[model samples]
Target: MNDHDGPTPGNLVATVRAVLPSLTPAAQAIARLILEDPAMVARSTITEFSAVSGTSEATIVRTARALGFAGYSQLRFALAAAVAREEPERLVPGDLGPDDPLTDVIAKVTRAESEALADTAAQLNPDRLGTVVEAMVAARRVDVYGVGASGVVAVDMAQKLMRIGRPGHAFADAHLALTSAALMGQGDVAVGVSCTGETPDVIAPMQLAHKGGATTVAITNNPRSSLAELADHVLVSAGRETAFRPGALASRISQLLIVDCIFVGIAQRTFETSQAAVRATRSALDEYMADTRRRNK
Candidate 1:
């Protein structure tokens, strides 16, 4: 393995650029490919990457080593970690440690959010997103399945989609979710939300939906996850992991952004229909709220 140290080759794009003035032309070309889009590099095999980046295989190894990876595999792993780190919410204005002054926490959180945006912007696949958006727009029905924190996001997605006139549902329970999946058929769409993409509940429903001729999409921090493989398309979220850090906050925020983006895209594509749906949803909600208020009084 090429051994070099910051994060991954992709995470170090800015660092590579800062040092580019000192690098050879071949190295510069390789650096450009990684910086331009790390996911592209992550998806590529060494031989394929070398040819596309116009650098020799040896140069690729050197580049990975320069990035502080033991080799290409290590480089990829580093990229995964970097992606994970960006998957959370931006730190709020004053969330720094007690030992840190208010200003320090503010600065740290600001930097964290900025980095998260940058990582997600860099990591997002427009083409893949477009494909999923299209599927969502054309689907006969939509179902979202997730467990735990991810289940919450799935419900949020369903709520938003419902507002836009889409017939969507979120199942927090695994057995009911699998049953829901059985009800899906051709031309429908199913989405699974799992930060780890390993939850059996989410996977079972997603798999069942797919087998029923529904198009399945997996949104997760782990692209290599079993859920991701079960999906017809995958949307990746940026996430970060630290020894003392919790994965919930940031990962949820990142996933929410992606979900919101998809919802908006669908709304735009069906603007008039969505508007009507929104109106209907508001009416339904108003009636339900009034009934509950009356019963309580």
Candidate 2:
């Protein structure tokens, strides 16, 4: 409800999930109906959909607007487009049962990861990604912030940037993140990584960095989330999780893919410098590898 931009229309399912937490109960019922059977929703009339969702026509319109659509008509068009683009081979993991076999578990998890990656790629706005990359390349320093599982992603991103001759630091601790962000000023970039985009530990530092005159970017699934509201750029990821997995594996895979995209974009812009820095870093690790080999022998 802040000044954040609405969701993109290219990937309706991802958009639905991203905004699910913020939807009103009546709107959420309609959202769930669409999510469960997008193809059916695409063909259903407004009257038919209202009956299926057990909500009023007005609530359905609100749900459509909440998802960044103009109204039910636009939402229907987007859903139709999405259903048309759906791949036959693509797998959607159902609720896992306790007695599921190991093979089934592997299949389902891998399928979820695959779908998350594909959906994220489809929904990602290239122009936004380019803007973030350009900002990072010109930044005097970069500060990455995340908490919980996202903390690992932040660290990975910092390492990638550092290896490309960029000076960057990652903070997983809330206090340290705030302290580091406080020191940032103009020409610096602060990146916040959070799946839900509502983590106070991540959002607080990002807000601080913004107030301190640094450019802020949010890598999250929800484009309208609190962190996104404060960001200069928002890079969204997509993932669907079962109750058992929660936001664990699928979100990580999607976030890592976006991280890799940003890293590669920056590297491409600073080609010779990035190549040299990567080689130097690799060379510096040779001695440790040699020592380990000798000890093993």
Candidate 3:
């Protein structure tokens, strides 16, 4: 069995980015060197990498482990594969420098978001997503659980599914979420949204839903997290967090992309009904818009 739980084998940079925050200081030093230039690292020997990263050989091995690699040699091979597939223009976001100007910050942030989305798309397992979508489309009802920023994403997903004539609800409150999850059965679907995949508020409800026999899905950045372990299907997202932005923007963007994918897949599966429902919802909104226009006039 494969011991690594990070990104898929060919996506070394993304795997590193996803686990970077959890690595120790000595390991991070080695990781930074690899991230800065994966191709260079791939070509370098372990001793060279240790010297360049200002870390010991043991630190290098530990860093490799933190990235879900069994050892330095495996990491090196994966890095080589990543280098072969890497695009010249693709940019991986590094730590935000204190003296970066406004323009540079904007560029860096946009690049980070782009990379996160790309990595997520690359790492997504289509069979897993398809299975979840099939379960959701055939479900009697769907319940989504999230807290804080993830709660907002859950609401967005629920709204999308509802607009497409699917019976879906989002719960952010812990008590309410648990209550709702407890009522789910085999024909129901439950989705949990958490970037870190360790949010207790989100994970508990998902666990309840699973125990209740609902098909459980987890959208998270960490595949090794408890949420993923509990889920029937796991959708992974990729984003690197900096000191200034902990689990902010990039994570949200990545999660939203996954939400949109699930929504679109379901909508496509029930095309005619979804189209009719969308039209009906739009007509209802149009009437409200007309009333507001008349009032303004």
Candidate 4:
């Protein structure tokens, strides 16, 4: 369920990251090794993994259980399943190099975006999603916060909510975000979006929102991130990129995927009002355009 309760099959890496912050130093090292290359961990024996990871077998077993596995054997089985599901011959992190032609660039970019969405879907738990949706729909207002690429997502979420007859606001400026968050109370839902989940711009407002008794939510790639720690609900996304690939590109795509789902869920729950709102907005726009044309004529 990506609830950080435990990892599902072929989703070991994401779940491991979700719980990494709570693990001991020794356990964190093992978790990092698995994140770096699960295939290698899957193939390595417990003794070899311990030797390479610089941790004892005892710590390794503890790490496994801490990650929600019954033991080391279960952890290995999950890691192996995750590795076996990787795309064959795919680019490492699906990054485009300087020498790649335009054609390859097009194909590679599309493939990377597609996989990011798919990976996020695989990790997303419908129950978790339902909970977030319920919060948004019931709140008196929804406030979304982000900076840079994530700011775009925040704006989109706010705009969609407004269209569906919900009071929504988005903030990119740190001061204004905190100002709004400070006023939010139990009737508000505050969503902070950050790819790395460590952006100070985002964390500050989220902190304020939480302190003000708002229901806070975090949308991030790293589930164990600081931003995630402040929220009542966490929606984790997936990002696959190389050092050369900009962090904003792949991460933003996954963020948008979650935003889209949230919008749809809200709309589905308020079907009558949502449809009426859309129709009214469309009619108003058409009337404005027609009046402008007549004046020009």
Identify the leading candidate in terms of TM-score.
2
Query: In candidate 4, which residue pairs clash?
Result: none
Give residue 164's error in model 3 in angstroms.
0.6
Where does candidate 2 have its weakest 10-residue lDDT segment? Answer: 1-10
The count of residue-pair clashes in candidate 2 stands at 0
* Tens-digit lDDT track of model 3 for 1-297: 013345444466667766665668888777777777878888989899888888888888888887877888888888777777763235355557889898888988888888888888887777777888899999999999999888989999999999989999999999999999989989999999998888999999999999999999888887768887898888888875678778678888889999999998998999999999999999999999999999999
Question: Model 4 Cα displacement at 266 (Å)?
Answer: 1.0
Cα RMSD to the true fold for all candidates = 10.5, 2.4, 3.3, 3.1
Which residue pairs overlap in candidate 3's backbone?
Answer: none
The better-scoring model by TM-score among 2 and 3 is 2
Per-candidate TM-scores read 0.64, 0.92, 0.85, 0.86
Error of 4 at 126 (Å): 0.9
lDDT of 2 at 153: 94
The TM-score between candidate 3 and the true structure equals 0.85
The window of 10 residues in a row where model 4 has the poorest summed lDDT is: 86-95
lDDT (tens digit, per residue) of candidate 2 on 18-48: 8887788898788877777878888999999
* Candidate 3 lDDT score at position 182: 89
Candidate closer to the true structure by TM-score (higher is better), 1 or 4? 4
> Which structure is stronger by lDDT: 1 or 2?
2
- Summed over model 4, clashes come to 0
In candidate 4, stretches whose alpha carbon ends up further than 4 angstroms from where it belongs are: 1-5, 13-40, 52-55, 62-70, 83-91, 292-297
